[model samples]
Target: MALPTGPATSWLQRTGFPSQLFETGDNDYELYEAEDEFVLSVEMPGFEPDEMNVSWSDGVLNIVAEHEDEQRDRRETYHRRFRFPKDVAEDEITAKYTNGILEVRLPVMRGATVSGTEIEIQG
Candidate 1:
């Protein structure tokens, strides 16, 4: 028996199972900076838009989703958190789900910088 290339994905996405339950640790996403905002795209299929929830607090972005099939007595759950480097405009953050992809836009505040100490290299 042989496995497929690339990251392993789950097939029980519809029956209360998230995609890629075994591989990637369910944190598969594409993140990049666009102008003054950060864009994130995550692949999530077999769930309705109403089942997804997105929120931000402090410096972390949280995404939680769940689907319950009462007749079958099954449930699917997905949860992931992300932290930003620079300060983000909490009120301006927006998210959308289309074609099984979750896209989130986090606007960066004007002239926001991270407060941390610089690390020195060892010689």
Candidate 2:
């Protein structure tokens, strides 16, 4: 028997998933790299700032959100984690939630060395 292909892929592709989030499950997010900072955007519907948690620990960045609708008796939860890059300044991370989207900005360290320097040999 042959497995389903085109329609199934299309269904998955039409979900408005954030870039780079397909590899994970249940939630979607996007990441952007800039000259002085990295920006992360996550899609979260029906959630508030108080319901979400974000943290940097042991070189890992984690995001978790949970909410329950008492009237409808429904619950929604989201969790996603990413490993921090070598040049990321953990202490400089900031986040904001607006219009059902969460944006996190990670600023690059000002005086940190990104590469090795070369020394001239004595003549």
Q: Using lDDT as the measure, which candidate wins?
A: 1
List per-prediction Cα lDDT, in the order shown. Answer: 0.80, 0.73
Model 2 lDDT at residue 15:
54
Q: What is the lDDT of residue 28 in candidate 1?
A: 70
Tens-digit lDDT track for model 2 on 1-123? 643323334445455332232234444788877888888898887999999999988667899887767775445567788775546788789999999999999886776444546789999
Q: What would the TM-scores of all predictions be?
A: 0.74, 0.66
Specify the poorest-scoring 10-residue window by lDDT in model 2: 16-25
Q: In order, how many clashes per candidate?
A: 3, 0
Residue 4, candidate 1: Cα error in Å is 22
Please identify model 1 stretches exceeding 4 Å from their true place: 1-27, 70-73
